[model samples]
Target: ALIAAFEARIRAQPVHVAAEVQLAATAAALPPLSAPVDEEAEAPAEEAIAPRAPQEQVRVRADLLDNLVNHAGEVAIYRARLEQQLGAFRAAMAELDRTNARLRDQLRRLDLETEAQIVARYQREQDSADPTFDPLELDRFSTLQQLSRALNESAADLTGLQGVLDDLARQYDVLLQQQSRVSSDLQDGLMSARMVPFDSVVPRLRRVVRQAGHDTGKQVQLRLDGTHGELDRNVLDRMVAPIEHMLRNSVAHGLETPAERVAAGKSEEGTITIALRHEGSEIVLQVSDDGRGLDRDAIRRRAEQRGLLKPGAVLTDTELDSLIFEAGFSTSEQVSQLAGRGVGMDVVRNEVRQLGGTVEIHSVVGRGVTFTLRLPQTLAVTQAVFVQIGETTYAVPVASVSGIGRISRERFESGTGGYRYAGEEYALHDLGLLVGQGPAKAEGQAQVPLLLVRAGDLRAAVAIDQVVGNREIVVKPVGMQIASVPGIYGATITGDGRVVVILDVAPLVRRHLAQRPAAEAEAQQQRHVPLVMVVDDSLTMRKVTGRVLERHNFEVVTARDGIEALEKLEERVPDLMLLDIEMPRMDGYELATAMRADARFRGVPIVMITSRTGEKHRQRAFEIGVQRYLGKPYQELDLMRNVYDLLGIARARD
Candidate 1:
């Protein structure tokens, strides 16, 4: 039905139909990725999902944006440095005659990269059948090409004039790294510094509780605590809706009217408490009422009816409480504006989950239903564990990394776009494949490495090549421009000057979900597994050899020849493919050279994952925009490392 709806919308746009088909084509082409998503039994306790704790106090302020003042200051400092560079550039031009050779060398590099971009553009044109874009007629000069040459020339000319200035420049870079490190620290401090009191969200909510007294004809009193604690302002920004929603549920559904309280010889005024507190690394929030508690039987019945629970299934109390979060499972006896139309609580769960937090519920028959929420403390910067999948590397927050394992691929099978893992099914998205290339050195030829990361109650297994070690990184927003990229929560700076993105597993999951239909999502919600393919031609190379990748539960596909490969591809496109060099009739170089020339195979990473062992082959592949490079007889050990270099899997390392 979603597909039918999308097809209808797509048919409305003749121009977009091709892109739609291309997207669907891309989906169809995906091979099942390995499913390593299972709860690790021996995983460290820190990564295990925590039960809901008591509400914590947090101080918040309305002027959180004012703290961004320091980031603006960084722009000013950069501008001042650029001005100095401008003056130096002018003075150096006087000696053009002496260093012309150096300028030429720089220009040569620029020219080469520029030529590569041009050829890449040409490759795109030749690949497309649209006929309107003529590659030869539209020769656009690459801006990067021009900048590269200019920088080379400038650096060379500066070599002779002032050793002191050069020393200062290098020193400046060192100082800049120090300054960046300092700025990152300050950013963390500022995130904590600007936190508003948690009590702020409650006062505004208290009035609503008052209003419910008249509307529902029920006497109710509300109390809250823990407003003085400091919280990351960003977290507070999201706290309002859920808090209010929970309060409304308390008033409308949890509380008994005055008549019932009187009949029970209880006081007419009911009590609801919104309490908070801090426990170690988490801030907890809770909503409680002295009224009827949730009906576990009703929830289980509803869940069973919706296929969320197996009929007559035995479940623990905690598992039973988790059922209310499933979509369309509302315990409310009737529909109301606040909830029970079946959408409110799940949104709250997902929102909290995105922040690397969790939610749970508890109840007593005659007392009340208490909804507990746990949010991270500080929310500014976090220490993360970096790991590799195949050739690509990714950073998993040490806060959430449960454990690492290697699954046998022989036990898995592919169905549609994803694969099955363990007895439970999981959509296998190859880290290297999803991000655009095989990772730098991790061909995944050996046994695949799996890192488990938990978000809320869900445990996900991220496949990678190896672990690149760990770091304490300051979380920085990646800005709005590229915010949609999967697996990145925000940007962070390494101890070095490099900036790496903080991984946001929830959004990565949500983005993956947003790409699929409802039923596909349900299939995923089940403990199903998936398959992933590696299509490179190398038979013995580590990245493509044996069942190394198959170890992680991907249904590996190999083709000895291109014709046979294309047939396999049309029959099913793997989640990723790594091509090789020097084959019969269809050599790797020619295959890439020609495939990039066709529209059908444009975005696939046709890496020359072989021992081509020449600068020309590497350069040529780069010219046509091959995703990444690797030497022949590759080792699975380096798969995730390369993937990180190609994609940002392990960029947060020391």
Candidate 2:
């Protein structure tokens, strides 16, 4: 009956009644319900779930991280300085202890002597039967007794102080060790935070290769290995442009067109590979291309046209390969969007150098070319060798040093123009002179310590006044004014609180090679002369000595004192030296000792002639290896005999 009523209502108002009519019909077709359910049967759900654990990592602003790194590096520098200071303090304590022991021994001797004198006086008074001679008077305070007692008390106090100082030194040492460990950990953590994977720049590198191949109308494939390798974020960011430039160069210059490759029996597609890996403390990156290699003839012609090489200049293959990095040097015939403006490789070299790194080229003319870049694992801190060149200290990156040795000043000036090590000849350079520090004071040492360094294909032996030992240094940037200076890469603070310049070896080697030809020519011309050096403060003495040597058919060099003589010795070594004992700056004895210690001048006989003709002076001169000692107003014949004997030459006809 309800379904019929709903149907009649739907016909009256079809749109509104349709849903009600359908509900009524469905209800009429269903079976009857059994029972109603209870509301209590169902349980309520929990209002909230357990809270999630806090995030373990959070992003930090780069500048904030960089500032933290700087602070940590400062802490490290302070720790190193504190360690040195502690060592110095320990040495002072040891000296103080020795001084105290000596003082106590002297006081004991004084006390004993005073007691013996008092006993002797008492015995003399008693033996003479003097009534005023009292036995108690012997024990009474006298000036000598009082002085001895005071000395004994002071010595005892010094011994107590020494014990306290020793304890304090030990405590300080413990503290310093703890600080060192903490500083090392903090630096490592900060550097690790700054590291980023190599794949961070892989996308951009691929884009560079793709775009370059498209523009050059060549088929090129980019392959990457060791993408998981890591570098400091700052280093990776700076390397992007340089790596991109190399990729473009390989595509434009290294690869051949598809048709050309096919004709040459190579695959139609060319491959360029970028490999990254860690080598010891450095990160090595290599960009290589398997295609038509560098055209040696084309590069040679360009070098000639650019005047970098003389026409028909004879050069080894390595030497010729290095010329491509010269600024504004290119072998491309026509200027194009990709190349021929002559700008890429030099910029690449400069960028790599700025990062405290080195770049090298390995190419086979028909095979291919590979560019290798070796960079510090991190820019924040690096291992460097500190060397004292003059009053100042400088740091050389350990990565650049191949070996260290001591070369006699004689061997350096032997007109060989270089030092040989491991069967290879390396050009020798004076670090003090190269940096405009003038000649370093020899400080009585005979041999100069030198570092054998390699920069790319170039090698040189850099002579320094002393090796200050190797250290891990925090690198700091110099201001814009100093940054433009050649051969200076950056600055570091030593443990002694001195700011040392970190040398860029590549630029130094380049500068040396650039000036080598002229230096060699000059050395050749002066090598034939038997040079005699006269060192005296008196103008008349120098003039008379020079005149005698000149008359004897020998070349003469004169210096006002030992300092001047050392400076002149840089030019050439003399066959024999005439030294005066009383000259200023550096005395004759000091000079002789220094010369005898040095292997270069040890064979050169020295004659000391001074106004002070005492036996003591003569003995000291002979002890210092001076061959002859003469008093003032020496006989001319005597001087000539000694000179001729030392030179191993026969006397000339009178």
Candidate 3:
């Protein structure tokens, strides 16, 4: 009826005739409202309406997942602490058992002695000719017998208690093992949840390469391998920018124009390959291009023009290549859309460093250039080696440590400030000094502990006071204020609840290489001077003694106390030590004793001068191997004579 009414209205107004005719055709094509339904269709509809399966996956907020991972890490840390406590308890139990055995043996000996005394008393009574004397009296109870019986019963009770404790300890150990397994699984599951395949970023990278190629008017093909490899989502997110920069850099600077490529007997299309894989605990990413390689002469000339290098400064190819990462350094003749302005490479290096990673560049003259980035697999938790630099503990990522050993004084070249490791000579840096904690002192031994660390192609041996073993630590950012500090990666809380700084090995190695030449030059210039150390709590005394040594042409290093002296001694062993008897932290006699105990300082001559002039004081000083003991208000001539004699040097002409 409605269609008929519309058709009549359209016919009255012919201008709407076409719309009315189309509407009538659409209505005629529709099925009638009274059409019948099939019973079979109803049955199939019921089957299709059955309940759907629940979703197997759910989306979770990123911050919520990170919190769960952090909680899991906390569980792991507490588990470690529990393990340490269990070990200590086990040791204490063993010691208690040993003590019980000793007490039982002593009690047995006492019983035997009591029996012998009774026998002797019985003999004495018989020898006295007493008619009432009886052997049964010898068995009569006494205070000693009662006390012994009571002690025996008490020992038996203790033994039973020990057995119960042993059983309880075993049960605790089993429970601890269960907790450890559960904690490990939880941490693993959370970490896995945060991981993403490398291919997740591949599309974005390809887009970047495509755009860069279009901008540069070059034909470039990007090849990606190991797309299935996975990394923590956070690490991958931060890496995307650097990877993009490197791709753009390859497109603009690494690849050549199509005509130039053809002139060089190469294909018109250039290829850039990016490969990702896991190397131990590190994720290794390589970005390579098949184009004209880095020009060493061009880099050198640019560096010279920027005053970064002297005109005739000698540098190896490797050293020359490193200058490209210097901030605002470039070889381009003029600014352009991409290549100039000198910004990308340095930013790339800093980004990688902040991620606790190292960047290495390898280039051949005519082949190509490859940039390798070795980064931690995850920033959440990592295995680290704990070391004692001075009084503080530090954590070094285990991936950076190649080896650990001890080096004797003879093996360390003081003039060169380096040691040999794995057949390669590497500069030796004191971990304490590197961290601004002063030089690390050897623990009364000539053989100091050394850690061989590597960052890309650079390696160095770091001297530390002691190795505190390894641990699984949760990495925490040190916040923005300290984020730019070199050699410090982050911070972590140890199992013992102490916060320790995580050391970034790449910057340390770079710093050592950068400063080595100057340090070597200084060492050479001061090699002939005899260094004398003056340790005293008195400001006047330190100055007076230092002045005297300096006047005599001796290189003087002063310390407020023995502790400071020990720190300075690690830098350079002094020829002689002038010590004050009374001082804070460590006194002169204690210092002398420690020096005598250390192999490196055992032969160093020590002169003790103090107001304590008692004979016992003098004897104690001598006993500590002090070569001379002079009282306060000592004659300058006498002191000079003793110093000259101990050092085996000629006296100055008067």
Q: Rank the candidates by TM-score, best first.
A: 2, 3, 1
Q: Assess the local accuracy of residue 94 in candidate 3 as a C-alpha lDDT between 0 and 100.
A: 78
- Steric overlap count per candidate: 63, 1, 0
Give the CA lDDT, 0 to 100, for residue 196 in model 3.
87
By TM-score, how accurate is candidate 3? 0.69
Q: What is the lDDT of candidate 2?
A: 0.83
Question: Residue by residue across 1-654, what tens digits does model 3's lDDT show?
Answer: 657877888879998788888888888787776779788988878778995687799799999999999888778777777777878788678757865776687788887877677676677767665567565464665688678878878888888888998998999999999998888888999999999899988999999999999998999999988868999999999999999989988888889999999999999999999999998889999999998989888899999988999999999777888898899987777788678889888998888877878888999865789999989899999889999965589999987888897888556536355767778666677675566555556644668898888775677888888899987788887887887777888898766677899998667656756776665455445324577888887766877888888888887888878898999888778889899988767988888888889998898999998999999999988877888999898888898999999988888689
The sequence of per-residue lDDT tens digits that candidate 2 reaches over residues 504-568 is 76676667567866654554454234678899977779889889878877778888789889887
Measured on C-alpha atoms, candidate 3 has an lDDT of 0.83
Off by over 4 Å in 3: 1-55, 126-139, 390-392, 413-425, 436-447, 466-468, 479-485, 506-654
Positional deviation of 451 in candidate 1, in angstroms? 3.2
Q: Roughly what TM-score does model 1 have, to 2 decimal places? A: 0.45
- Displacement of residue 542 (Cα, Å) in model 2 is 33
